[model samples]
Target: MRYAVSNQPEGATFQVWRGVLAGASASLVGIGLARFAYTPLLPAIIGAHWFPASTAAYLGAANLGGYLVGALSAGALVRHARPATVLRAMMLLATIAFIACAFPVSFAWFFVWRLASGISGGALMVLAAPTILAHVAPSRRGFAGGAIFTGIGLGIAASGTIVPLLLREGLRQTWLGLAAVSLLLTVIAWNGWPAQDAPSSPVNEQPKAKSPPAPALRALFAEYGLNAVGLVPHMIFLVDYVARGLGKGVDAGAQYWVLYGLGAIAGPLLSGHLADRAGFGRALRVALVLQLVAVVLPVIASGAALLMVSSVVVGAFTPGIVPLVLGRVNELLAHHPAAQKRAWRTATTSFAVMQAASAYGLSFLFSHSGGDYRLLFAIGAAALGVAFVVDVVAVARSK
Candidate 1:
């Protein structure tokens, strides 16, 4: 009879922490610095005469568009290349983009770099969690996932907090500083990845194919799309909305973003814990409710304390929902791992595409609405409301 024990090497536990940190660093550099940094930096960019404020929507959309392209590319790249190699290369590219943006170039030129940044961000978002999880024993997978997901919040918080302080030096210096930080994070994470890996694994595409029903699948796709729609206001304009929309200065706005980031740090761990006890579907519903509240709160209340709560909830659940949906997908496809892989790719792509596409639409709406972010927030809240209903239906059907 064989007795069960962890098959990990003696130092595996130690390396797991390193891998976790590495994964978080990936998030920090990609989502934290490369992608979401635009939020706090948007006002600074405008103030520095780098670009017209009118182009904010296009700029945000460009990043999301590049993110979509990156997501599609990852699906192909995984088939032919090593994930570790790909992950590191993307980090390096993101670092370069960050540094390059320090130069005040044409709007078109800066747009290209932002696009590249988004692509790298998208790739890392898809890749990092799996890479980190590979280092942990199966029993601790949730912990690994939580550890990895926290990187988004960490990055968000860093941007919210650090970018404001650095702006005192000037926006150009801020970009240079972010680029250096990105380089450091990339190096640390690169070294933390397993020195060896199988030629292919879950992070890479393997042919496992199953199709859920068309209507149910469509509903899931819709929820994925709306998730981004509900999120764009906070992601792209939270700082500006607070500063310009609420009559707060940029500093106050950045402070709110920091609080938001702090809340984000709690989201994934609590979400995972909740999933462990209540089931992924139930936990997801809880997240959706909180997210809905987060979106609607700002529209209904303007007080300092209330808006702070709104910021926290938005920040927390913004990155929180992704893992929960991925968890649900895994559950939905428990019987067919191959199909699950395909489903995940589909869900992820749909989500990215919606996010990319929605940027243009929603931004146009905001600009057209005479810059009344309340209208924007209202629309965003409505999107979340639809997501809530769609999610409830999808969860029931999945059951």
Candidate 2:
């Protein structure tokens, strides 16, 4: 079960890729299936009379609340358990959550399981890439990080395509099907993690009360949080907007979701390659600009072609921004893995907090404004604009 760090060329390459697969599996199950699968199912759940609209919406938000909890506690959990152990546990927890969700015994029951799924996702998000990347060579870490996050895209793609097909059978069957897939992935990744913890460096081994995070790191936290706000509109409402708001059928909305999934699949690899070639800072800035435009596209124009573009572009950046921000953290804290983990954790927590707040806030706004999808998109675009400006100013000041 142990994948010892190997000295031989082929052995090292295999080991790195194995760890990558494990990390990807964790992301795929934890974030992709656990968090996103719920989105496509939201309407179905409401339609089937499983829950009323308001309760169903609150249940969706429960995951976000639990995610914030997970992000805040991931480090402490790792301190008590091996990263590999923690990763496996979280994956199992996600699988269990999926199974538990099939019953829909009561509002409280669904809420608890949904929240647990989010916790699994948040913990995996915080821990997976950094742990796996710790064993990868620095020169190749960008690509490796991107590969790991591809699981998220894969999950999204599956949610769009597979969930709808599964819905044909029944909601309970769909949940069970997802659990089967998650369990299979969990088994595949069971032994791919490195056997030992990442080697500690002098920088991290210093006294606990070291200097505060650098200014750039601080700015990154804010920018990342803002990016979360920017993404909320599409993440929460894309399918709904297309299907309900735009007067398109659910099938058409699913098609748009599929396109979004396609963009997501390409986004991380492209962004990672860009980070390798151009640097994480520049890659992040470019991503922000692209995301800003994508978010605003719907507001400016809602043609079929333009809506498709918005879906794909915004979808690409949804999960795409993750690797960029993670890479930027690594770049900023090079040779300081512990610090990088801490900074990444803080960034993730910030993202989760903002995402949860914005999801609810935007939902409230949409409800109050008579389900104004354009207004939601406009607000998201504004958030991205602010994030881009903040990042630019931070980079200038750092220079």
C-alpha TM-score for every candidate: 0.85, 0.93
Superposed model 1: Cα runs more than 4 Å off:
1-14, 55-57, 105-108, 134-139, 195-218
The C-alpha stretches of model 2 lying farther than 4 A from their native spots are 1-14, 200-213
The residue-by-residue lDDT of candidate 1 on 4-75, one tens digit each, is 124435544336677778888887787877777777788788887788888854776687778777777876
Compose the digit string of candidate 2's lDDT tens values, residues 10-84. 555336778899998999999888988888898899998999998998898888888999999999999999888
Per-prediction tally of clashes: 1, 0
Candidate 1 clashing pairs? 208-338
Number of residue pairs clashing in candidate 1, backbone atoms closer than 3 angstroms, sequence gap of 3 or more or interchain: 1
In model 1, how large is the Cα lDDT of residue 163?
83
User: What TM-score does candidate 1 reach?
Assistant: 0.85
